[model samples]
Structures are given as C-alpha cells and as structure tokens.
Target: MKIPFSLPVIDADVIAEMHDTLTNTGWLTSGPKVQALEKELELFIGGGNALCVNSWTSGAMLVLRWFGVGPGDEVIIPSYTYSATALCVMNLGATPVMVDVKEDLTIDANKMRMAVTSKTKAVIPVDLGGYPCDYDAIKEVVNAPEIKELFISDNEKQEMLGRILILSDSAHSLGATYKGVPCGLVSDVTVFSFHSVKNITTGEGGGIVVNLPEPFDNAKELAFLRVLSLNGQNKSAFEKNQIGGWKYDIIDQGLKINMPDLCATVGLAQIRKYKNELLPDRKKIYNYYVDALSSYNWAIIPPFKEGSTESSYHLFLLRISDISEEQRDEMIRVISEKEVGVNVHYIPMPMLTLFKNKGYKMADYPVTYDLYKNEISLPVYNGLTEEKLHFVVDTVVAAYKTISGN
Candidate 1:
C-alpha cells in the first residue's frame, strides 16, 4: 500500500454536484455556480469578498497589476515559499525581494519592515504549510506613519491603501487563522489555491479574498477582479445573452483566468464541509503525528500551533535534528522504498536557478536554509486509514534509524 502526500476530497456530494453542473446548468464557464462559490467563500472568510480565479498565480497577478505593481517596484516575499509567490511578482515586471523566515516557516515581519524602501509596493507574507505569518506585526509595520510616508503610490488603489499591501500567499492556508481571524480576513488580500493537492479543491482554481480597508470598497474591488479575470469584459457570456445586454465594454487589457462553473461545483461542495469535517479531520492527523513523534530525541516537530495562530493542517512538516541535507534526502528515499511517500515543503527561493541568477543567495537566508535542509513533509489528507497512519509512522522511524546507522 502506498500513501501519497496529498489528495483532494471528492465525495458523493462533489460527484453529485458536478453531475448536476454538467447537465443541469446551461452554462459551464464562470456562471452562477462560480458566483455561488464566491458568495460561499465570502461568507466563509467572515467579511471579505471572495473572487474565484483559474489559478493562484492568475489571482495574485490580477491583484498586483490592479495595485499597479510594475517596473521598478519591489514585492517582498519569504524565501521559504512555493515559486508561485515570487513568480506572480516577476510576471508583473516587479522585483521579488527575498527575505528570511522565522522558525515557524512564516515570513519574519521585522525583516520585511526593514526590507521596505520607496520602491516596495507590497509584502507577501506566505503561510507556508498552513502556518500563518505574524500579521499583527506586519500590520504594525505597514500602518506605521513612517512606513506610510515611505510608500510611493503608482495608482488609485495604492494611494487608497497608503502603504505596503499585505497580499498573503495563503495557498496552503485557506481555513487557517491568525489570532482567530481567518486567513482570508487576516491580510489586505489573501489568495487561496484550490489545487488537486489542497485540502479544498476546484481541480485547478483559486480564491482571492479582498479585505482592503475603508475608502476602498471590497464589493467594487470584487466586481473589478471578476471582470479582470474574465478578459476585461464588463459582461460575461451569460449576461450578454440577456435582452439588450449585448453591449459590453472592455474595461482594460485583463487576463482570462475566471474559474468555470464546472470547477466551482466541486469547490462549493468542498467548502461547505471544510469547517465541520475536513479541517477537523486534518487536525486529528496532525495531533496524532505530534503525539507519536514527541518522545523521540531526533524528532523535531514542525510548528502546527504557535500562540493564537492555527494551521489548516495542510502539510505535516517533520524535521530531524543534527542531519545533513544528504541524510534528510536519504530518509525520504528509504521511506519511499517502504511504500510510505513523503516530500520536502520547499527548496528556498535563493536555491532555485531563477532567483539565484538574480543575485539572491541561499546563504543570505540562514533561517530558511536551516529549516529547508532537514524538513520532511509527511502525508496528511482525507481517507488516510488508521492502519496506513500506523504504517507511515513506523516507516518514518525506520527510515531515520537507517539513515543514522542506529
């Protein structure tokens, strides 16, 4: 038996909803189903307006572009994140300023505060492995009078925001919280990836939660992003079909990244169950891992909960003390040989060729490097059986022993 790192929840409701969508709904691409999903997510996020996009990259790009992030601008991001966090910045012709992370694997808010310059338009705090970054600290940094004074507004949105926009890279933390506030409402804006590997999925889709402050209407911003995702067309095909609605205007040169109704159906089914079922289930698995590994001398348990912040329990990131990167890799190899699959959360951004060529170095980010060198992400998904869980725990311990020659 093999255990994969992640799997999407596709239950009877998902299939039923998807079937109804394929046959019942007259539309497929970005219609009422997608609208329903947006509304549900909006409510799920507590107060923010949620916009469904084709992917996390597209949603993030749309938000960045809307904020006028372009040439000569810098978007600060943690080096310990998936490439999407940085790629979205590069796509907008803005520079992604690499920063080290805290032990929690979240961006260090103070480091970001120090990294700010006149060119700094945004600071993307990545909730890597579902653990939220220090939002209150970041809020203080962005809201400081001096920091606000340093902000150079390039557009109406920027001028309204008056400081660095906290666009959270929350791809792994949709249901997570920072100080009891949900991930969606924790930042100026939060983008959630509904990928196949995520806790909640829409096959390949994303949700952009808008929580921008006053003078910036979130509802209006939602409308703008919705149109922006639909190739700048103020009206969708469904709307165009209505009487005297054929006349539509191209607001701007926008992207075609709207989530389809077909995909939205799956997301809708998943989101409804997330709070009551999915999230809690993942938490159970997370607790079990911690309880099992706590007694071991070599086991360095990942930060699942630190103070008020709580994870979505997306990835069970386990670390081993006093191990080289080679030894860590060997552990994964040995574990996989036992048919227990595992993975590493990330290779720091500076270690990648794309950022390395841009003069960013891994040595510059000691904290990110320290965590990355020994981290191993274990499987945490729905339907992982008790026997499989036991097998996984045993397999990891056995692999560690093999690597250490113990």
Candidate 2:
C-alpha cells in the first residue's frame, strides 16, 4: 500500500526505443526524430501543426516572443497555476495580470474581462488538472467590442488574429477535449507538457500547436517555430551536416530551446501506447476514485466530464469540505504515515513570495485561495491497481475523520 503521488510510465519498450535511437542515429539534437515526434503529435491531435521543445516553459517563452509580447504588454493568467505560466510572461519583460479562477479550478472568464486593459496583449488560460478551459467563452470576452477597440497590434501575428491572443497553458491537458474539439484546436495556440509526471512523458519535454484561424497559414508558423527553436538558424545541425548544406544564415536572435532526439524517442514510444494503454488505464484509476469517494460527505471530486468536454485525467484535485488549511495539512500527514501518498495541486500565486513582492494580494482572489486551501491531489498514475486505489480512498477518509474529530 505504499503508493507515491505519481510516477512516469517508462517501460522496457520506451528504453528500447531510446537505445534504438542512439544506435541508429549519430545526430541527436533536433534531428529527424524530433521532426517525427512533431509529425506524430500533429496527427494525434487531429489538426493544427505541432512543434516539440525542450520544456513547456521554453515553448511558452517561444510563443510570447513569436507574438512580440514584450515590455509594456500585459498577459493575463490565473492565480491558481504553476509559476511557469507567469514566469514566461516575465521573461519577456511583460507584466502578468494575475486573475482568479472558477470553482472547476479553471480561469474565470468574467475575471478575464475585468482584468483586460488597452495594454493587454494576451491571456493564458491554464487547463489545471487536465481539464480544458472554456475557450469559446474566453474568446467571446476577448472579442468584445469594448476590448477590441482598445487593442493595439504589436506584431504581424497579433494583427492577423485581429484581437488579443488566447495562448492556452495546456501543460496538464494533452488528450483533453472541449465540446468534442481536441485541445490543440480550442485556442489560438496551445502548449502541452510531457514532463515525467504528466500523462505523457519525454523524460522532460513539451509541444506547441499553432491553431490560428484562416488567413494565417499554420504550416508557415510551424516552419517558423522550428527555426526559432534552434537559435534562429536557417538550418539545423543535421541539415548543415548534409552535402553542400554547411552554408546557412541566422534569421534572428532566438533562444536555444529545441527538443533533442533522445527525448523525442521516449515521446514516440509513449505516444504509440497512449490511445491504447496509457489513457484507458488512467481513466480506470479516475473512475475508481470517484466511485470510492462518492459516499463521503466531505469529498468534492474533480470534474472530468461536462457536456461534450472530457479531461485527459491528469491529476485528481479532491477537495475536503469545511476544512482549515491546517487540518488539511494534518490529514495529509496522517495519510503519509499510513503509506498513502497525496499532494496539493497548487498554492495560489498571491500567497507565494514572488507574486507577493510583485504587489499581488491573496485577499483579492478569495475563490482561488479557497480552492487551494482544501484541495488535495491524490495518487493517480499509469499502473495503480484497484486494491491500492481502495487503500488510498480509505486512508484519506480515515485521516480526515481523525483530523476533524468527527
């Protein structure tokens, strides 16, 4: 019953893929395998071209730079997300307008409307715990007449979109859907994480999907991103090593953030098993948690389905009713002593030191803090069995009862 909070699903097949890659290819950095991974991801997403990068943070930074989100610009983001979402904005010397989230733990569209000003360049709606944000609603808010009138275009990409950019921070949700539409097709641009703890893993990697509408060619953007991922070079090392290809040009000064072939090899192996094994197995664990915890009065389960939308079943954010933050901590401690693993989804940015120093106040975002105080992310991974799942639920319930003096 010693369950850890999460673990990567790296089997012998994945290892063999890496070994095969090393044996067959001498060029490891941003080579054919990276291109192949991007192609496979594009196909899996059903539309939109994909670009693989070393990490989601790097991908986000690339998107910001590509869109020309720099000094004096403001990028809106939810307070209840990982710091990377905001840090990426900061990296470009832009201001991050921290906003609140709704009960489902996604960014509140109404708050997004309130946060927008003439200087607002973009809004990054995070898919917390693998749940897709309400892109249609967010788009509507961004396209409102009042807001649209204030928009000042900064780059060619920004002018083509004709409004504020909806850059989705979909780090937790890869295979998720909204109204039967895949994540890659929901926003103007979407980013996915393949971190070790994410649903898919590349040891450490991420993907970017360009979904800008008609008049903006996604293929051209894909090519542009490939160049940007390397140091804005016209040719990758593999291409430069080819016959008479050594002569190349520097397009622009870009960051070095391309995904290496070694990591892409793991991504390829995981994706092959994704639709068949990884997704289904994770779904089973999620269902088990819901069924086991349904009878508990304090259990507030995470939302996996709402109308035609479905989560990728990334992390389970379970909330405890009427519990103090101290009591929640005590319960987690008790569960850990019993060898059942649990964790918090996030600590609101307003409560963190960096954001506090930036003049963000926790009191302003009551809903975000409320969600963070009582939420616990339970053990949900690839190989968790029914028996281990039961132990997890039972341990959590017992710990709560003990801590609450019920």
Q: Compute each candidate's TM-score over C-alphas.
A: 0.98, 0.98
**What is the clash tally of candidate 1?**
0
Clash count of each predicted structure: 0, 0
lDDT of 1 at 114: 87
Best by lDDT: 2
Candidate 2 residue-wise lDDT at 205 = 93
Worst 10 residues of 1 by lDDT: 301-310
Can you list the residue pairs that collide in candidate 2? none
For model 2, state the Cα shift of residue 305 in Å: 0.3
Q: List the residue pairs that clash in candidate 1.
A: none
Model 1, 1-406: lDDT tens per residue? 7888777888899999998898998788888999899888988878888889999999999999889899899999998999989999999999999888998888898888889999999999888889888888989999999999999988888888888999998999988888888889988899999998998899999999999889998889989988888889999988997788899999988999989898999999989988999889999998989999999999998877867778999999899999999999999999989878799989888998988888998888999999999999999998888888889999999999899989
